[model samples]
Target: MFVGAIEKVDQFTRPIHFIFRYYTGSDIVPGTATLFFVNEEGFAITCRHVARQILYANSIYENYLKFRGELRKFEKDPGFETQRTNLENKYKISAANPIRVLFNFIQCVSAYKAMTIHLHPTQDLAIIQFKEFESVQYQGYAQFLKDSRFAKQGRYLCRLGYPFPEFTNYQYNKVSGDIEWTKEGRSKTPSFPIDGIITRHIGEGSEITGIEMSTPGLRGQSGGPLFDPNGTIYGMQSATRHLHLGFDQVNREVVSDGQRRRVSNYPFLNVGQCVHVDVIKQFLREKKIKFYEQD
Candidate 1:
């Protein structure tokens, strides 16, 4: 599991923080996502959503800041017609090409030169290639199970990830007009291990689509590798389903005046969704990326 951020201290320089999001003032992990090496040459796999953030988080965050600033201006000068007009115009322009903003931010920020991201057309899986960096090492890498017959119900599987940040140092610098992470806060300890049985296979009979595990896939676990006891990578943890239980029982008389009081503590089953390994294999073959799989 890896945690870090795309940090920007000034306009000319932005370094990609890999091992830890921030480690200066506080031990923290920002924009955390679990990633694993697919091959020896710095190629890795993660969820498409996480890759989206890694590539465009700053642009989205910057948009938020701009929107907030405009709103704040409106709050300060309620009768200023020009301020309202300016804010409205900003909104119109921003909505048109948000992706352009993201790529622009990437060019301005990311320390590394280039990155190639391949998103699975129909699946949540994604492949990330670090073109500039070489010699990146991991403790180990995973090889997928080539045969699809092993994806059976009641089969035990496990996944690993840095689910949630133990401590977050996310902060916005008002002066610099930039989002920054304090150099303090610790990464989530003991990389989470979620174990469960394969409840069933996704898709129609004889056409495997995905895998449903009996574990709720948490936020940070997205893009994590799912493996079995025999060291075969089965799939990638992608999502979870929240089956709501009954509402919470709370004393309305004491808790609130006379409103319907119901707590959000609903019992939810951990139904972890995983993208099948075959989907990943297809993607790799289409891209001609090298990977290991059992014959």
Candidate 2:
């Protein structure tokens, strides 16, 4: 069962890493999303934001290609071209979001292509179906809970995903631009679980809008599942709400005017937000996908 869950993730939500290039340096950003089968035919669920990113990335790549064409015309000037090449090497040459799906023990990668994305008309939900691919794997699936009893506040739920890839993929090569995978990179870091209590339910009168979790969901854990102790699906982790704490003043040694200054920084409290699974079911049924439901 454990291996089955891991394999299910391998087929669905892919660990994505992207580098944001700037004139100064490059920043490595890692992300995690939850995806689980709705049926044997491979219909799955995830956050709308995640799907939008895949599409946005494709658009960025196309734009980058066009920009490259414009740059090629400047190659006639040797000095101008040399500086351009230096800039390209210093930053990122391609605006293309090289989202490598960390699957198959991170030995292989798949560049996600958004084929079909049906987003909920009013909710932050998206249903995605990948074009038939060769490396796609299949395994255990998730079942939605139709009973509203499980939606009560104070209920315990757990989520699973690769939350901290920096720790898992410990070493990275700055020069070579590669992940220094420890232990041959074969021992893939399995998705771990984090448990939290439902602090409150939002959108009360009508269909549930969202739910508040006691523990804040990390950046990489978005689109992951929120399920109970028995593994009954409840909601999809959406985002975190950062409530501002009071600001504090800290003395800085240097300032723009070459004088010491006091800098104020505001702290925040992060609370996890989840989209109710009820919304997921409605979206799926509208699409004609079959799944387990007892309502």
Candidate 3:
């Protein structure tokens, strides 16, 4: 039963990693996002901020260590496998190597799936489509996010994701990554979870809103699907933080050089906000995608 439950959450959430091109003092850097596919049609939803492709990001450090190492240097280099195996066996793991996970957000968009991107990055909501795909492994996501008949306020909800920042993946050579992860075909591995209430049924423009979750959510869990006890998507994991309120005023000042400086910021924000399903449905209409449901 416990194993079955894990499979349930795995259907919707995917491990996300994106490649980015960045510029440093001299060299360009490549990066990836911690994201997964929603509604499983190869269409994925992640924090706009998370998926933002920056040309110059100095804030991010550490990643793809195995690929960045001498082993990677020998990726195409002949006769380097022996040396790479030796190094991997010795250090086991390198301190400088960066680790991120990859997962497939299958192409599952179709008619009557009741899935779509509900919100955007600034609003932090995305609609998604969930088309059924045959598989012994997943049994079709119809068992998961597609149904809404079980929707209720106090039902049990589950969240899935690899929230660990100290992530790692072993590789055989430059072109090949971990045996289990790379070509091995692993999908939607659940890392952690917690329980929460719906607070209210928020459809298009419902005045009902509150702190949707009493418990905290993981960082990488930003766009993960939230399912009820009967396995219907109540909402997606949005955000959580201690509410803070402050005032923003332009502290204008003139320097001796006759230059004025000003500062501005948005303040008085509370903790944890969802884009609401009303918005989610809107995106579905715009995208012309349907949701799948199980009887």
Candidate 4:
């Protein structure tokens, strides 16, 4: 039902690809997040969590550099191994802590000198402004639904994002001990669209702030656009909530592959939670960003 709408949304919806590595590991891990253009001036919207990770990437890389510099100072000493261990302990480098984080805006801008991010004080929404860009790579922008009353429950909506990290345009620099984006390997990943009915409305007190969809928002779909069959954006996908169905089976016998087996099953329903279009519009207006709306 939304085949054409998905094509239209794909013009403005872009993936933000990221690569990171833990302090104790040399392997590079790649992931993705979504963002959509709101205007021709290079402004876009994404979840605050995504923006925060972009901002925190600098700190992670800098800390790693500092540790490397400190370790070099003790390389010539007779107790080099001891000093290395001491420094490692001092920096608290571990498997859980990332030593490097890097990201690139995929097909959104040709080139940019810098970018600015404005995070909502209370909402999961955020605004991004690309500065001094040579050209805009995205084809179109989002046209939000004007009247939110049209977004009633039982209406089916589709969300678009890059949930599978199929892109391989990144590598780990073993010599430099850094993870960097490379010119080789595949640079594009396919976008996925999932459709579901509006199950409920989420609110703070009496003011509605979010929409709950019956289907779960897959991983890497955060910050994706939520729209109807007409391609009118209703909200931005922020997160997913898992509801316990209260159907629990312990050590139950079941037939599988022509064999009998005992399995314990605990089921949960995952639902997508999106930031409402009204909240998105208000945030953009407060930031003096230009956007489009349709009746």
Q: Which structure is stronger by TM-score: 1 or 3?
A: 1
Model 2 lDDT per residue over 8-54, tens place = 43444444433333222354444455555666555677778876766
Residue 218 displacement (Å), model 1: 1.5
Rank by TM-score, descending?
A: 4, 1, 2, 3
Off by over 4 Å in 3: 1-5, 18-40, 53-122, 127-139, 142-153, 170-190, 199-211, 244-273
Off by over 4 Å in 2: 1-30, 74-115, 131-136, 166-187, 245-267
lDDT of 4 at 90: 88
Q: For model 3, how does the per-residue alpha-carbon lDDT over 1-295 read when each residue is reduced to its tens digit?
A: 2345557656645555332222212222222223334343444555544433221122232333533565666777677877766765564434333233222232233233332333463456554333353422222442333334455456556655556533333223434432223443333334666566544453435453222654566666676656555555555666775444556555645454576666565565333334444444445556675545444
Clash total of candidate 1: 12
lDDT of each: 0.62, 0.63, 0.45, 0.93
- Superposition TM-score, candidate 3 onto the true structure: 0.48
Better of 1 and 3 by lDDT: 1
Pairs that collide in candidate 4 are none
Model 1 Cα shift for residue 235 (angstroms) = 0.3
Model 4, 26-95: lDDT tens digits are: 6888889999999999999999999999988998778778888999998799999898888878877667
Residue-by-residue lDDT tens digits, candidate 1, 141-235: 56789897878899888877656555443454569644455666542233566788999888756767689998788777787777876557888
